[model samples]
Target: MRSTSLTTGYDIAILGGGVAGCVLAARLSEDPGRTVCLLEAGKDYGPHQQAWPQKVLNARALPRDDVWERHAAVHRIRARILGGSSCINGCWNTWGSASDHAEWSRAGGPMWTAPAMERFRRAAVEQMGLRAVPDGEFSLWSRAALAAARELGYQEVDMASPDGGPGYGTPLLNSVDGLRWNAAFAYLDAEVRSRPNLSIISGASVDRAAVRAGRVRGVDIVVDGQRETVHADTYVVACGTFGSPAVLMRSGIGPASQLRETGIRTEIDLPGVGAQLVDQPGIFVPLTPTADLNTSLAAKQASGDLYVSRMLIRAASALCPDGSWDLHINPTAGPPLFGRLPPGEYEAGISALLMKPASRGRVRLRSADHADALDIDPAFLSDPAGHDVAAIRSGLEIVQELAASAALKSLAGPAADGHPAQDLSDQELRDRVGTYWHPVGTCAMGTPDDPLAVVDGEARVRGVSNLRVVDASILPTAPAANTQLPVLAIAEMLADSLRG
Candidate 1:
């Protein structure tokens, strides 16, 4: 990794120290010759981050005073700490379809295509201390669900790359010791933080990307109630889907009309900087467990099934190369009352989400103030083409079928949804199946002629110099599964491009 000079003048300035930025920082710092400065608007991962190992536990605890929680928004999903969303996100590391990537390439972001993404995926997954396994640990409910799918002639497979086809398998989590593993802990926490060339500045909110002469020069930041400026020769914006666009528009680097209307000067004419946002619509199908499998402190300690299940999951990953959506099958103490439950409450209920969503949405500025939250038009049920509605509704159908299966019936009872997963008409299901919290796009990858593309496959900002975006925002479409794995791949590919 490259080390920056103490003089504060560096070769590269990476804004947003989340998963993408942290990975980029670590990868760029590998050179050790060039100076790299990583600026995080949040704080370092402290005791809070180190405490929880399970994603559920972390999710339940993240809203507190932890540095990770500081970056969260009431309507905005994701952690704002050094590791970014990965810190608080469920550690389900699954990839999407090659079809998804092929579409991205065709859409104008060629680097995101499966072939190019493979190398990056290898580097990120291989180096990040995670390994694919053969047999995944699934709860009785989960296994029954897969078995039900199989009975329906849906071939159950891991979502991994096998025969170079669009594979499916269990997810590759960022865990080490039955605990949650995010970007800060996986790569940056130990490596980058220890580097003299890399400096992590947390608790500082980036007002905007500082621009001059149609190029990014630095960032205007507010740290500890004091305003300061930092510059670098090359600037990379890793501030995330919303943050990147927000910063760009505030810096006068976005839509001419939007900027002018806000009394902000236009630095570039790119109108797509904050458009085309895509995320998944999340819906839960609740069912009653046939057997009471709720865990107690004593039951948890005595249950060898938990450990065996996890190992089996890892084994499945090793054995199967075709990555199907990984499972987090567990015996819930009880069903979620308000979409959430205390750690051991849910009784044998499973939370199933489409690992990748085919829908797309957009992010736009509601105002100019740094503290003012941006209005995110996730377009969850409002896909421009209505593909989102169909996909999510189909997913719901799949869930219903699984819930009604004989195997699942033997363990868990009929599925029910207060939001009417069953009662809602097909159109209603499409309208209501909401976000899975995975937001992408708003900085699409397309050709120069493409009006909505903000960056190309190489992550270069369209119509801008010395500036690039390396986050989920570049995705032309969301994957068919969870997002962490794909984002890791994106970071790896962008870093390799920078190195080359």
Candidate 2:
């Protein structure tokens, strides 16, 4: 990490040193002559894992430290660290179905086709050191979940492969011995950090890009209460889904009407800058574990081998496209996600996640101040056609069946509430909805003809010559799987394009 006072002009400036930003810095800095600066709004903690906080390194639980907003709404939580959400998210990785790529290809041209992006996906997997769940890591509850899935007739398939259809499988993990291996550990290792051409500046909050005459000449960032402009020939925004659009809106490059409301003069009338927000919403069905199951889970926890979840079912609802799944049936047991349990006791539950939802949301700025919170509405289960609600209901049916399976019934019983999740009304379902934390599509990708497209297929901003957005924000649609690996692969693919 370098001091901002010592920073000067560079060939390229990569904003937001999250997962994608780390990859971009490591990849683009390969050419020593092309200087690159990577800026992060949180602490870097250096390149060594020992220097990172224990909570951030523990893969057994999601850490709330070093996040953008402490104690904020659960759905609005995002990391504010050098490695981004990878430092705090579940260490699991899974690829999306072929239908997800089909949608991406439609918006971003042939480059986004599954076949075209296979190499980059492989590259990200290898670089991240992702591996299958070890037998030791599987708790007694996880074993029962797998058995229940098989009992329900779901075939075992490779969850990390894009060619697979509906099935039950364990996702590849980016954790080794319960230690989270975040993007900084994978991409910006000691060797990469030694590169003279690459400068990583942490605790630098970006205000906006200095856009002049359809080009970004510099970016205004505040560091330690002082503002500075970092000049660069090119700029890439990798601020994840939420932060990316907020940055663009602050730059006066969004809907003119909304910008005016915030007292920001519109520099570019790009309606898509903060529109079309999407995220996966799910409902959890809690189960009461048997005394025997509790004992086994306590033993596993004492042995330091307890993991909340290890396997999941990729299931297709009746309304889902043929040969694709729209729901993820996850069986989790261990420590509760929200609160602590009594000694020797554990929380168990299964979640039904609506993967491909028809509902859309928006991200809008409340005021011109960068410190103000942006209005983010996920709009889950809000589709006019009721497709999203119907899909979730179908998933709940599967969850009920799984709980009733002989394999699962012996380990746990139904919730005391005695209410079948599928029987819930529309309003009830909405009240209980939770996010999968996979948000995308605010700055969607599309061709020039698309009125709402924020960037072109190559990730170049429509009206800005030297600025691009390379992150989950440009995904156009949410993938069926978690966004971690896909975001890594997208960054790798776009790094190649930017290099060319």
Candidate 3:
């Protein structure tokens, strides 16, 4: 990490040095004359892989360390490290469907079209060194799952391409030889970090932006237990889906009623700042693996080739739009995500995730304090129409079929007395639901005529000049795939806009 005093002003100040922030910093600082500063609330492990924690660098499992809250609810497990959630995620990279881009274009502009965004997507893929899963990485369970999907009549398609239809395939990975290659390593490499005009500050918490007359003059941040203000010609908020809205509300940029309740004076009454929070919710059906399956998985683990999941089936439910998938059926067999099993025993299951849900949640500030936890309600399957629930049921039906397939049943059988997920009541499904960790649409982008639009098509704040938000929060809807690749591509595209 390059050390620099925060006392000096800069041309651009990017808050929250996560995935998007890193991209913006690297791209915006290309010109020697432009001064860029990236501030992160978490620790920056520097520009070396050896300096990072082993758990964070290991791609085999999700790292609980360096997260915001320890032992918190599963839904709130977001990384507080410099690379953001990429440092702690599954290291999977996949793109959304054409329908997703159409929605984005409607909300943002033509720049969001699939053709327009292709170059940026390709750029992100190259920069991150994303690659297809190697043949050697496929475990016995993965191979069987692929065969099962094939037997089910699903064609194989390129999961990384947006043009593909419903199919079963492996996602591009950001891991190399079991090492997690995070955004920090990709975007903030040694060459980028050596730039004299760029500054990377870690362990600095942003309190609020000092806005006056719809213009941000400076940002008030807390570093080393001291409050200080950093002035910049332009300020960009990339704090992510949850944290970005919290910062805006603290800066008095959200719903008037909610801000007043938190004792914050309103600067811009943007009701959409924290509304429309959407995420992919799913239910995992546990299976009892046969002794033969356990032996094979254990052997793979011993060879350092055990990956919980390597492929997924993109399936469309009855309610899904024509020619698009609404569910992701993932078959996993490996060490349990939570607790450990007896030696040689592994956790095996098939998870059906509702990729395109109509349910909307919200993020609200409990108080004006930056350290205080924000109130977040995912409201999974809470759509009054029950469309989301019905979609999950349809996905569960597919799960049952996949599990009963001869290719899979021979290796892992149904759990004893395990209730069929499709038969579970609404309440029961909600009780057992888990998130896919892909959250978006809090600070949605849209035309100025839309009241809920927090940012405009160019990512500029609706009522604030020289301030913008370029992150997942600006996405008006959740894509039909994991958010990592989409976020990287969006950031890459927005970096060009910021430069222009």
Candidate 4:
């Protein structure tokens, strides 16, 4: 649905109505003089609360997140609806630490420093109603895990600074009034949406940017199976890690060999268009609860007032690094979406996440068509140092230690798959791992001299004018935690830069 006037050209055209897209469109339109168009391939719920899907608004673990593309276990569970994956993701509000931002600054510039971005962080907390999960809501299983975490020397279980050292605690989340408060609600409220200069078009799939002489002139989009061109003075590709790269590759702007093979004419020979993909790979240990406990959690979940709150365990300095956590140990009791085990096989799980993975992946065009899913090879656990698997193993050992302790005695079941921890092979490590739902760096922004860079420090596309990439795709590296908050903050900072 188009909301702006029938103008032939706009000041800005934003591709992908995800977290960053919604934010950029809103912030840019605030000028009132700029004509902005936000195009989304997915359905938009609009400004009315009743228009939103109950499943999308409710902060529950829908089965939509578990749908995976089976190529080496690529959990391709991104939200196709408005607000992007934040519409479908677990609502944990994890911001990576100061050191994480410091690393980002080295790639981009001093503008990406934590202090420069802190205002956006505060804005997110205020607008999303982010608050701590109360102690009263802790399940019987979580209470035991809390005691176990303390017993295992994780004294500070409360959520610490995103840049600080490890701690185990119930975290702040984005759920308010039992519904998911996604980016659309935060940035595209009725007041913003009603602006005359702003237009939002849903179900508008972008094919490619129409570039001429290294400058974006317009975008070719597919609306209701018909081709149309939307002219814009400037364009922002915020389609995300997998998408922004695919769009560029299809527009004849990627590696020359890949473009030639696809039967597309070459525009710019960008080797990093779909390279340097990074994500946090993880594994889970499943455990069966006593029949009585299982029955109880099932009943509470049916009530739906509140469900699926959890605490996290981050591994300490000895295991990963001195400044930041290397492992994320999270436990779930009621949520089936957290199930990595086979269907109906277990009632509880302990997920061991390998944060700061050294292994890199690549996303390539399956075909020139925007509809074809990209060929994604995360190459997880391929790190030469083997540090990724080692840190995860350390986290699993902690899970075992917790289970065997008196606090959780008889509450936690036996080890999953019957494989002794030390006996598991490298193949087993690769086979058992999955995603933490955070993927990044497919269009990483860095110093222009860097060969792998796609966009620059200010988010402007390298070698291209009137174009920028403002999304998780431009994340130089994956932040230490979930990508939702960080992605939004990055958009806010870039929006300011664009305005200037």
In candidate 3, position 410 carries an lDDT of: 95
Q: What TM-score, over all chains together, does every model reach? A: 0.83, 0.99, 0.99, 0.93
Candidate 3 TM-score, C-alpha based: 0.99
lDDT of each: 0.63, 0.93, 0.93, 0.78
Worst 10 residues of 2 by lDDT: 1-10
Overall local distance difference test of candidate 4: 0.78
Candidate 2 residue pairs in clash (backbone atoms < 3 Å): none
Off by over 4 Å in 3: 1-3
TM-score of 2: 0.99
State the lDDT of candidate 2 residue by residue for 1-500, as single tens digits. 69445348899999999999999999999998999999999999998888989999999999998998899989899999999999999998999999999999999999999999999999999999999999999998999999999999999989888987999999999999989999999999999999989999999999998787899978999988988899889999999899999999899899999999889878889999879999999999999999999999999999999999999999999899888999999999999999888999999999999999999999998888888887999999999999999999999999999999998999999888988888889999999999999999999999888999999889999889999999999988999999999999999999999999
Tens-place lDDT per residue, model 1, 233-314, is 8888888888888888898877898888778888888888887777665555666554344443224434422321221111
Which candidate, 1 or 4, would have the higher TM-score against the true structure? 4
- Give the per-residue lDDT digits (tens) of candidate 4, residues 212-272: 7998777889888988888888889988888889888888777889989888788888898
lDDT of 3 by residue, 1-500 (tens): 44456768899999998899988999999989999999999999999999999999999999998988999889888879899988999999888899999999998999999999999999999999999999988999999999999999999988899987899999999999999999999999999999999999898999999889989999999989999888899999999999999999999999999999999999999999999899999999999999999999999999998999999999999999899998999999999998899999999999999999999999999999999998999999999999999999999999999999989999998887777778889999999999999999999999868889999878999889999999999999899999999999999999999898
